[model samples]
Target chain A: MLETAVFVIRRDLLLAMRRRSDVLTVLLFFVIVVSLFPLGVGPEPALLRTIAPGVIWVAALLASMLALSRVFAQDYADGTLEQMLLSASPLSVIVAGKVLAHWLMTGLPLVLLAPVLALQFDVPQNFLGELMLSLLLGTPALSLIGTIGAALTLGLRGGGALVALLVLPLYIPVLIIGAGALDAAAAGLGAGAHLLLLGAFLVMAAAFAPWVAAVALRIALE
Target chain B: MLEAIDLQCTRGERTLFSGLDFRLRGGELLRIAGANGSGKTSLLRLLCGLLAPAGGSVRWHGEDIRRLREEYWGRLVYIGHANAIKDDLTAAENLAIACALGGHRVAAGALRSALDQLGIGGSEHRPARVLSQGQRRRVALARLALSEHSPLWILDEPFTALDARAVDIVQEMIASHVARGAAVVYTTHVELEIAVAVALRIDLGAAAV
Candidate 1:
């Protein structure tokens, strides 16, 4: 299992390196999205600060989903998915490795880049830490759930739209808690409950989503 | 040995095939011959554990394959119609990654020799997508040389888009694999000269009304 995970991680990283443009585009999209929100809403520091949590979290979610599309889609298209399915490693390990790779490529960058965007929104220096933490816990859940979308939409017509449609609804609870945590921190209230809720969501999603994704992949393969 | 007992499959409202039984022994090759949409691929998928057998079971070494799915899969390598090569990776890198996923290690020298033998030497460093269809097929076939662990090879349309020389190379490779006590099940519509005689044949004709 560890061997499988390491192999997948290496493959994912190598692919991302080879396609440097796609990864850069994801980060660029995130920046463009955060920048657009302030422009559309007008650059009132107070209003931007007030809405910063929602804006940043929403952009992060969308940016991460964009990154998610490349996750299993490339493998599925090339028939690597079938090889993985036939591999000795359990599907759970393959899915877990894939989700981790997705997070590294998508969620980790988003979290790491959040501080810069948070500054753009004039978010309180004190709340920046909480915002990052909320995202750190919440984004894994997003990747886990989005995997099912990636799996189900494998080989489907117009898979891009199908993945977005299937994944966005499932993302609502995580977004609610993720953005709420930052909001509570900014308001000088306890954000622990929201963070805990986000953690719980991540746990459940990590445990269950891979199995669902594996089954969905099997169906798609058939 | 690999055996399927009363295997049945249905695609939605249509029954693709049912009560399918076949056995493949070590050092033997099974050719699954069928026209397009005759469920040849579907049956291969079922036997491979990619698709579940609706009403029967696949057994390996007298144990139900489902109960031992991981072990059974560990021994089998299935290459589908789509040559699973990543167009972005070089032939060597592609074959190396496949070896890792297939749970074996292929030394770089071995991969090079294999690719070279398969007539991909000039473009082993080039991205596979830029290669011709026959070249891509060679890259896919290069995977068979990456491992000595797997004993069963299930290939779908193993001959699609291959030149005569390429076809002969692949046929010899399969022959060598079987001669080494490995079992192979490959799907191909083309008739060709194989170095070894096929041990069993399963041809699916038009479904009875």
Candidate 2:
């Protein structure tokens, strides 16, 4: 099972490498969205600092959701999805691998870029670690939850927009807890509570999302 | 070692077929025959555990396939009408990955030789994007050439786009697989062109009983 997961992750990463632009588009969207906040709010350092976590977390949420469609769409289009369902590996394991690869491509970039983007808003340098920590814990949960929406909307007309609509509601909990972690840290309270909640969300999403998404995929294919 | 006992299928409000029965023991060839809208593809998908029947059950070695699930899938190779090739990967990479996904880790050399047998030998380095439609189908079909250990092969419209030479080559491959005591269930619009002595044929137009 682990071999199949690694094989799928390797193959999807190789696919991402060959089509570099798709991966870059999500990263650029996160950067551009986070960057737009300070300009729109003018040059108030205090205001930017206060809003930084919300802005960065929301941007990361959107960026991660942006690439969720690609997770299964190509495979569905070309008949590979059927083969995936029929693989000797359980469908859920293969899905977990695909989701992991997607997070690596789309979610990890947002986490890496958040501290830099937050610094642009003049968020206190001391709080940068908390901002990065919040996004790092939060984005995988975002990707995991986003994949359920993606799988449900697969092959629908207007699926890309539909993914955003279906997923944004589910994303709220992650957004709240993730941004709260930074707010807690910025206020001199420890971020441990919110970070632990985000970690729990990741565990729950990790435990349930792949199997649920796999079930959704089988229904779609049928 | 496969049996469909009184199976029924429906698409939306229309009933495609029902009370369909057949038994495909090892070393047998079962042909699924029907016109365009007659549910041949649905039946193929049903047999391979991709779709649940409206009624009845499909069994492998006398156990329900739904219960068997991945274990059942491990014993078969299914090629649908869609080619399933990725556009960016080279033919060799595509072939090797497909085998790996099917739980078979075929060596790069063995995969290359299978492509050779299918007559696309030297073009293995070219991405599937550059391969013609027929060549891409051959790449999907190449899974068959490497899948002798799998006992059941279900192919949907396997001959649709092939040129004559490729068609003959695939027929020969199927014949050899049957010769090795495996089973094949296939659908084709082409009229009984297979030289292999078929054990059974199900024409969905005349579906029931």
Candidate 3:
């Protein structure tokens, strides 16, 4: 079963590698969104610093969600999901592997890209590490939770906007604590409490979201 | 061997079929005959455990399929009407991927040889997306020859898009697999053109409740 999960993750990663443009667009969107922030809100260093963490986290959330639609949608469209269903592996494991792969392509890149975006916002050098950390821990939860919305809207015509509608409400807590963690660092207070809360959310999502997504997938496929 | 006992399947409020019993044993090929919307694909999906039956049971080796799903699935290979091959991958890559997904490993040379047997050697390197429909079907059929672990093969419309030569090759492969003690369940609108001595036919038209 674990082997099948690993195989799925490996297969998607290989597919992503071959279709490099898909992942590239997410990065470009990240850059464009971050660049737009400075242009839209004037280049005031202090103002950019004040809003840097929140802006980056929001962009990461939306970008990750954008990238995630293609995750199961492609497999579902191509009949791979049906084959996966027929395989010996449990559906939850398949969902977990897919969520993990979505994180690798979507969340990991967003985390790695956050620091550069943070710099553009003129965030203090002292707070860059904290910003990146918050994103790394928070983005997986975003991907994990985002999958539920993706699964729910799997075959819906206007799935993209519907995914945003379904996920943003569920994403509020993570967004609050994630930005709070970085804000605490900037304010010279301990960010540990917020980061711990973020980790807790990750644990909770990792435990339940895949099962929910699996059930949703079964419905969508049916 | 695979068998469905008094199986009843329904979708929504509509009962698709009822009291359908069929069996495919080692060294035997069974054909599922039905008209369009006669629940042929649904029946295949149910038999492979992709969908649940509203009533009755599916058994493999005398054990309920749901109870022994892993063992049953490990021994079965199903290729539906969709072809189920990733277009981005080459013909050889698609077969290797399928073999891997089925929990069996095939060496590169052996995989090439299998593709060669299906007369797909010349296009092995090209992406399957570019292959003609007949070639793609041949690529999927090639997996049956390469994987040893999947003893029972369930194919839906296995000859949907194939040339005369390709169809002949597929029939030969099915016959050989059955001769090697692997049970086969397949559906085809068109009749099997080749002369196989005997086959059990379950016409869904007559089996309808």
Candidate 4:
């Protein structure tokens, strides 16, 4: 199982490396959308600081959503999904590997890039740690749950929009807790409870989402 | 043994086939022959445990394949109608990933030779998107060489985009696999000059009501 998971991760990373433009596009989208909010909402430092948590979290959500539809699209298009289903390893194991790889490719970048983007909103140095922590804890859940949506919408016409519709509702809890953590920190309150809840959500999603996605992938293939 | 007993398939209220039974043992080649829309692909999918039959069961070694699951799948290799090649990866990279996924960790030299045998030798480092349809098909077919340890092969129209020379290469590979006592179940509309003595042919068109 470990071998299969590692093989999958290596393969996906290699593919992502070959297609660097896709990864760059997602990063640029996150950066651009977050940058545009300061322009739209006016350049009041107080206002930008007040809205930083929500604005950054929302942009991260949209950036991750932009990548969700592609989680299974390439594999399904080329019939690799069928081959994956037929492998000796359990389908859920493969799904878990793919989800982990997806997070590594899409989610981790967002987490790493968030601090730099947050500085644009004049977020204080103290709260930046909390923001990054919340993202680090919350984005895996996004990738995991988004995988279920991706599997459910695989091969459908206009699936990109449909995947966002299916996944954004599920993402609300992560967004709330993630942004709420930063908000609590900025207000001089400890973010422990919110961070703990985000951790709980991650645990729940990690435990269940891969199996659900695997079943959904089978249905899509059928 | 691979067996399908009274297997019935219905796609969206349309019955594709009913009361289907067949057995494929080692050293046997079962060619599932049918015209388009005749459930040839469906039956292959069922045999690979990709789709559940509406009735009956597909069995391996007298155990239901669904129950056998990974153990059954471990010994079988199925190449569907679509060549599962990634456009961004080179032929060598594609083959390596495919082989790895299929539980075969082939060496780099072995991968190159396999692609060479399939007539894509010199182009192994080029992205699959740059390859012609026949070359891409050959990349997918390269799995046949690496899959020698697997006992059963389920190929769905393995010759679709191949030219005459490539077709002959694939046919020869299939024939030799059967000679080595590995069972083969394939669906093809093209007539193949395989060197097997009386390869079993199941015409799904005639079997369908």
Complex DockQ per candidate: 0.74, 0.84, 0.53, 0.80
User: Residues A1-222, candidate 2, lDDT per residue (tens digit)?
Assistant: 778889899999999999999999999999899889889999998998889888888888888988989999999999999999999999999999999999999888887888778878887778988888888888889988988999999999999999999999999999999989999998999999999999999999999999999999999888
lDDT of each residue in B1-209, candidate 2, tens digit only: 89999999987887899898889988888898887888999999999999999999999999999999999999989999898899999998998888888998888889999999999998899999999999999999998999999899999989888898999999888888987899999999877556665567888885433
Give the Å shift of residue B1 in candidate 3.
3.7
Pick by lDDT: 2 or 3, better one: 2
Task: Pick the winner on DockQ between candidates 2 and 3.
Answer: 2
Candidate 1 on B86-167: residue-level lDDT in tens? 8788888888877777777678788899899888877878998798988988888888766545789998988899998988
Sorted by DockQ, highest first, which candidate order results?
A: 2, 4, 1, 3
* Tens digits of lDDT, candidate 4, B149-203: 8899999999999999999999999999998999999988898768885489998
Give candidate 3's root-mean-square deviation (CA, Å): 2.1
Off by over 4 Å in 2: B206-209
Looking at model 4 chain B, report the run of 10 residues with the lowest lDDT sum: B200-209
Off by over 4 Å in 3: B193-198, B206-209
TM-score of each: 0.94, 0.98, 0.94, 0.97
Candidate with better DockQ, 1 vs 4: 4
lDDT of each: 0.86, 0.90, 0.84, 0.91
Quality of candidate 4's docking, in CAPRI categories? Answer: high
Which 10-residue span in candidate 1 chain A carries the lowest summed lDDT? A68-77
**Cα lDDT, model 3, residue B23:** 74
Candidate 3 Cα deviation (angstroms), residue A70: 0.7
